[model samples]
Target: MSVHSLNRLIELREREVERLNVEVANKRAVGDRYRRSLERMTALCEGSGASAALPPALSLNCGNYKQAMLGMVDLHRQDLALHEADMAVSQRALDAAARKQEVFQQLLARRQAQLLREHESREQKRQDELATQVWWRGQR
Candidate 1:
């Protein structure tokens, strides 16, 4: 096809690749945060269990312990939400990248076909010129 259309396709592919990279990075970050939240929850459970063995007065700030656990629960929910959002974004990016990759493959095929045609045309013209030169020399 035309150069302009090819260039546009290339630009689209580049943009899609960029967007995909961003999304992958974001998903990775979200996964990391979710894992950390899980770790935090485990740590909180362990801490509470350990503190339960102590006397009430010294059981790891008894008055505020419930509130702290509640906060952790809230964070756990938020982390889950972030993870889901990240997954959706990652899926979209993957889809877009796949589409762009297909377009790139099509562009490559078109270029290859054009090159083959040009090569054959040049070879045919070269042979014709050589044949004409030989015939003219023979005539002379």
Candidate 2:
């Protein structure tokens, strides 16, 4: 393929890589938030007091409190799992995009080397012709 086409492909791949980077970052941020929330919930339930205080004027039976906390923790766990799955997929996409960009760059490098070799060969041929002409003139 032409150098111009290769350059264009490289540019497109770079853009794709950039976009995937953003997606991966977003997924990670979401996952981080979920982790922080789960940590807070566990700390509140497991901290100093045997029975953690509920919000103003509200209270639950011992059985109900445990059940509610368990349910909330389970929900957070599920949300975290989903976020991790999304991050994994985003990471895969980023890797693929980077690989494509590298391939294009390698192709471009090969094309440049080929062009340089052709130019050098032509220059050497021209120098040889000049030398032959000089020898012929001297013979005359």
Candidate 3:
């Protein structure tokens, strides 16, 4: 393939890598939000005061609230786990795209080098022919 085509392919790969990076970042942000929310819920559960001095009704209400908050925290943990899994997949995709871009760049470099050598060889041959022609004319 031509160097131009290889460059285009590399650009495409770069875009893919960039897109995957964004996806991973967004997933990480979501995970962070989930974690913060989980922390708040856990703190609320821990801070609940069901003191024996409190009225029975208030104590019962506090117990119910703690149970509900615990359940919400568990749900948040599950959500965070799922988001982490998705982020891992995005990271792998980004790695593969970067590797592909590197390979294409290497191939383009080799091709350019080969083309330069061929051009230099042709120029050298032409100069040698011109020199030989000048020598023959001098001999005459």
Candidate 4:
């Protein structure tokens, strides 16, 4: 393929890599949010334990609330686990995209270098031919 086409292909690959990078970053941000939420929920549950100072009715209510919060926390943990699994898959895809882009970049570099050498060779040959013609004229 021509150098222009190769360059275009490389550009497309670069865009793909960039897009994957964004996706990975977004996934990581979501994971961070989940972790923060889990931490907050755990702290709330820990701090909400029933105390002797509270009236019996209040104590019972607090216990129930804590139980409900614990259940919610468990659900959140499962959701976080699933999100992490999805993130792992996305990371793998990003890695693959980066590798593919690298390959295309290398190929483009090689092609450009080859074209440059071919151009220089042709220019040198023409110069040599011109010099030969001048020399022949001088000889005459």
Give the per-residue lDDT digits (tens) of candidate 4, residues 1-140.
77788778878888988988899899999999999999999999899865566999998888888888889999999999999999899899889888887888788889889989999999999999999999999999
RMSD in Å for candidate 3, one decimal? 1.4
TM-score of model 3 vs. true structure: 0.93
Indicate the residue-level lDDT of 12 in model 1.
78
Among residues 3 or more apart in sequence or in different chains, the pairs in candidate 3 whose N, CA or C atoms overlap within 3 Å are: none
Clashing pairs in 2: none
Q: Model 4, stretches more than 4 Å misplaced?
A: 51-56
Worst 10 residues of 2 by lDDT: 48-57
> Which residue pairs in candidate 4 collide?
none
Question: For model 4, how many clashes?
Answer: 0
How high is the CA lDDT of each candidate model?
Answer: 0.77, 0.86, 0.90, 0.89
User: What is the C-alpha lDDT profile of model 1 across 49-79, one tens digit per residue?
Assistant: 5566678886757536756776777788787
Worst 10 residues of 3 by lDDT: 45-54
lDDT of 1 at 6: 77
lDDT of 3 by residue, 1-140 (tens): 89899999999999998998888888888888988898899989988865455798988888789889989988889888988988898899989999999999999999999999999999999999999999999999
Sort by TM-score, best first: what order?
Answer: 3, 4, 2, 1
Please write out the lDDT profile of model 2 over residues 37-138, one tens digit for every residue. 998877766652443465433444544665677789899999899889878988998999999999999999999899999999999999999999999999
